[model samples]
Target: MSDAPVRTLLLWCPDWPVLAAEIVDGVPATGPVAVLHANRVVACSERARAEGVRRGLRKREAQGRCPQLTVVDYDPGRDARAFEPVVAAVEELVAGVEVVRPGACALTARGPSRYFGGEEAAAERIVEHVAQACVVESQVGIADGVFAAGLAARTGRIVPPGETPEFLAGLPVEALGRPALADLLRRLGVRSLGDFAALPAGDVLARFGFDGALAHRLAAGRDHRPLAVRQPPADLTVTAEYDEPIDRVDAAAFAARALAEQLHDRLAGHGLACTRLGIEAVTAHGQELHRVWRHDGLLTAAAIADRVRWQLDGWLTGSSRRGGGGPARPTSGIIRLRLVPDGVIAQAGLQAGLWGETGEERERAHRALSRVQGILGPEAVLTAVLGGGRSPADEVRLVPWGDERLPARPGPPPLPVARDTTAAGGGEVADGRAAGRRRGGGSASSGAAGAGRGGAAPPWPGRLPPPAPAVVLPSPLAATVHDADGEPVVVSARLAVSAAPARLTVGTAPPTEIVGWTGPWPVDERWWAPAEARRRARFQVSLADGAALLLAVEAGRWLVEAIYD
Candidate 1:
């Protein structure tokens, strides 16, 4: 094999992600539209760009730029599904196409150019054919290597033989597609590929390391990485046959998830990760439906399942496709499903976190939860979310598991702490006229802003300090607090206690002696609404048996509110 760079032809699709949304999801592409991932814009349409929308802008900023923008989540599967027909069209014109991503593909220019008379002729022919066959516009560029060709395709330019370095020199370093590297280089005043290419190769290797060295080689038009992708092993395929055809989308989704997991597990056993997958389904009437979905990154089990579900949805509902799978509806319900790993590579850059962010144990737990959800409905599992509130019940909200855990109400800003001089924190309450007075200061806010999405630490005034109660009573247990005289301890209208609490009693439990006590810390809520107003004096007390309880007096009735662990 020649060591020189191979002449490569790259076909590019502009705004392919936005177009894919329209094709697969039926979101209109003509209007201002943006695709976002993790709240950042990944791609946008021309109309959105006209309105000042740009990649990397936050969703809110993007929407602000174009109020009428149709926002869609980034779906790699949709891009792949929609681009499949375009690949098929190109395959019809030439042999051996390597998908660089959902939006672009590459092939050797030698064969196509020689067969079509010249590079220019081959490029024009491919573009025209793709447009005619797939009804999608595309551009073609011929250059010394895949990287150069990919950049060239942006403007439909062909870099002359041995001139790729000159062609790439003026382009910005961002064209290398390494954001961190580009940012670092820009900080170092190396703004263009030419500047980076001029750096000493040894120094580049030493400073930026192996990946950086590879990027350096590309900047200098030395992308010798061959187009010799390995074919996935046949044993990596997984299949399932059902006696009862899956007619409903939910049933199909459940089946898809199982099959996807099997396929992923098989691939994992081989120490591999799939970048592209082929989904095959057989209908009850013997109709066979096959489609390939591509992803820019390794496909996780959930991602594979999602693609399978989407494909099955399209087939079952006869969704129209501009290309690829077309609008062909299966004649009957699907009775069998199969997953083929079309493209895979040695697993890299993925391992359990050093601090246990992810591991086999976590994966097992996730799978178990997902299975439970499938059987019991998505809402079956619940998780507690902690937010701003005065009491335990008010602070906690139960949400369906896996949903974002955000506080229902933003917490108030942290208040300055003022310690009481007479008591443990607040002066001990006693029956009879209080001997000491305690004014509780603002409890320190755990998060100044109550753990808002932005991580602001605004404090909640008078928020209880932590060492939170281990168990908050579902319903406050009826209780009584008494003094040394065995009389009910009363809290006056002015928060004055009848006497120091000496004993505590809960429903059916004998009186227990109070070892220590603090507070007639008053809580008044909804003062503005008479119908909803509530007043309570709360106390934290330790019992003779070494137990602690949170007690409150409301409407002259004592209740055990919570127990400390």
Candidate 2:
């Protein structure tokens, strides 16, 4: 919307993956071919295009256009995998290039233009470098802005500054991105860009909104949009296809090493470092071999390759294979190998410590421990902290170190707990303070010993207490028991109010009087169950006999079930 001028470059590759596939693996550059999805067309080869086959056309329609056309599904994953090296190659030529998709990338012309003597030369250098790395032909276009550059790339036409509007005036109105605008133009008898541009801006804005005006701007080639920037060492992956299947361990290792170099180059170009790598090998019959290799620090290309080879060799020697002869082993023939870096962080070199001395030592120790833990089960190592909860069982929770960040427990807050069981008296800390003061000169350990052996005492209000022994019945029961006044009490409904007599019993335990009680807590949970088998209310009560419990009576009998901690 501003009057400021902007510069951009558009790069595109026609049938990029197919072409890259041919160049990299030396496949035949055959006849009319199309990249398809199931039976729909996504992109067409030049031969297919010459025969009038277009993108988004049905496979049958495309075939109708060129009866001899060969169709292949659009494999975006494969395409992206193949294009990694190309992006890396381009990165070597320009500092801030944006990838438009699987194949094309856009780079600002300012830096490259000045360095290479102009936009044209910059584009030429990019194409040349990219072609060499990816082993494929590429096209580049530079213009005033992103829209114009994109348009230029599609047509392989470069437009110099200040000539965009004039150039666009002759294009069809449909080029503006509003199919509806084309219909409108047709209705209004506007056929060309010049005719559309001749209309007043106010009229277009009022009828069509900003999109209509944007179409007008694009048509006029007045591109002023800035390039979107992306920061990296982004995670990088590399995959390679072999001319012949390789089954032998040494040959497979060689292939993996080559792929690693390419991957290493790509990652380095992005200024990224990775700690984990995964290698995948695909067999002739579509069988895939997957291996995950990890390292403590930045992985070198050769090291990654070695790990892949080792894993593949091990698997091939161990697993049984079908067909002629005896035990199966890696053959000398391999078709493809893909290596991917997993543990990616936006940092360079070894990750640093927070401050100075203590931080450095602490971080180093953590890293070492993490490496060891990664090899073992993640659950095998853990840290525990005091959590704010009503019961002792809920007070302390174990958390995985690397994968989890222990959240600050909510509400009444935590009781004091220890970091390690060996610390002081094995007490858990709440916030930064310890729980429960000890009397006299008793050591913290001595106090814990006494507390642990004596079981837990009653907890005060707002404080977490040791777990209580109580049974939760799945359903309510109907039982008669003697009240404090020695009278028969019959149970009905759900939760008993404080005034209700103790009338439920399980096993040989005598019915106890309710010393404390809370809530009917009505539950309609089983509304979806059988109509007659639903509905109940729950109650929490402490008896005069020192038994605290959750009980429910339904369907006539009390069932002793879950012990609420």
Candidate 3:
């Protein structure tokens, strides 16, 4: 690396998410707006901050301070998308610019500054160009390094050469951008960055962890974060803006496909693969829709198009509609649609054949399945999750893709059984059939037989399970079904159903009768709660075909939760 000052200038567009929302809604840029994450305020417009609504304030507290504050959900992708035009404008001003975050970018200003006369002059021209192109209000700061420049931009105060220490001295410790150090400094009654910077580095590190060391460097205005790369990245994504809004999904998909083809060619020419992609759609009335997707391996043009299609489908399907009524849906009539590649890594090894055995095959399959499922709806596909809880049924959770993956709960070892096999009390494999397979099938038979003797059955194959009915309509129904013979049956806590064979299926099918029975297990959850909060269960049943079923009867209902194949 060159031992130069790096000649970088940093530009920060303040409250990017709020501004992006404004742009999307075509809302007038007036009054204060704040973006929220959970209950805390994450970002606020300058107008809102001036009104005494600052980031980190509790929602109720902020509202009390700025009653007129317009609140919106914090969307990082929207902020990033809205910043694209700003990046393009800056790139034209300098030889190169790198986005440091959704709202901030850094570029070498040496050449541009020289051509424009001085650092100050170049910064002014860059800011002016952006103001002319859009309604976004921003700040530009030029200094010897990123740290100094960022502070200068925020404070609009210039620091002379070698004066970075003095400039950073008066700023709050929070400016160091390390949450822990800032908190510690507050506890120690040190409010300013300079206060902590003056402390011995060794002492700071010992008490505050690595953050103390980082604070020391930043307070001194010495930034070690390299410029990343000096050239523009190779994964160029193409987008087209339509003059009129297009509401048809097919049209949008077609246009998106054409763009992806172009982007793929560009990537191929550079021997690169784009792993991340973003799609943006501007609706007729100015509502902006955006999506960010990732591919584990090299993403093909067709895959890109499919992703765009899914995003639109998600929006069109009203997945955003939660409660009965809210705001009307944005007209599908799309005004502008853009596709952008976020980053690219070399594709040199991606073409290596014999995709089997290597990890790449799994990733490819996952990508393909994800695309198909996206079109079909997420609930169409599911992944099994293992867990151990009082409810033998709750021990395993099945979650749809892209949703929060149910975490593995610490408990008994894997039962060595699937949905077809039955899990006895404490989640022990109790059935020998292992669901749909014959007793002599494979390596699993020995284990299944052992488990079955203990009342745990292997998951059965090919038996279609009734669609879990909602006893109360939309809400999940928890009902007990006494078998035809009125024997109390216990069901698995997890409502997992395997076909008589364990193949996954779409839609719901009728539940089959139990050919064999195995368990009368008791499960008690929420023991720490009041007695009324606790639950109990018993399970086991037999089918006509000699297949054993594990059923759980809880709260006086007989539900066929799982089967032993």
Number of the candidate with higher lDDT, 1 or 3 = 1
Q: How accurate locally is residue 538 in candidate 2, as Cα lDDT from 0 to 100?
A: 35
Which scores greater on TM-score, model 1 or model 2? 1
Candidate 3, residues 106-180, lDDT tens digits: the string is: 887678779999878888888888888775677887776787787788855556666777878898988878787
Kindly give the number of clashing pairs for every candidate: 17, 26, 70
Q: Give the per-residue lDDT of model 1 (tens digit) for 437-487.
A: 243322223222122233465444334444457788999999998888899
Deviation (Å) of 412 in candidate 1: 19
Among the numbered candidates, top lDDT falls to: 1
Better of 1 and 2 by lDDT: 1
lDDT score, candidate 1, position 304: 88
> Local distance difference test, per candidate?
0.78, 0.60, 0.62
Q: What is residue 545's positional error in candidate 1, in angstroms?
A: 4.3
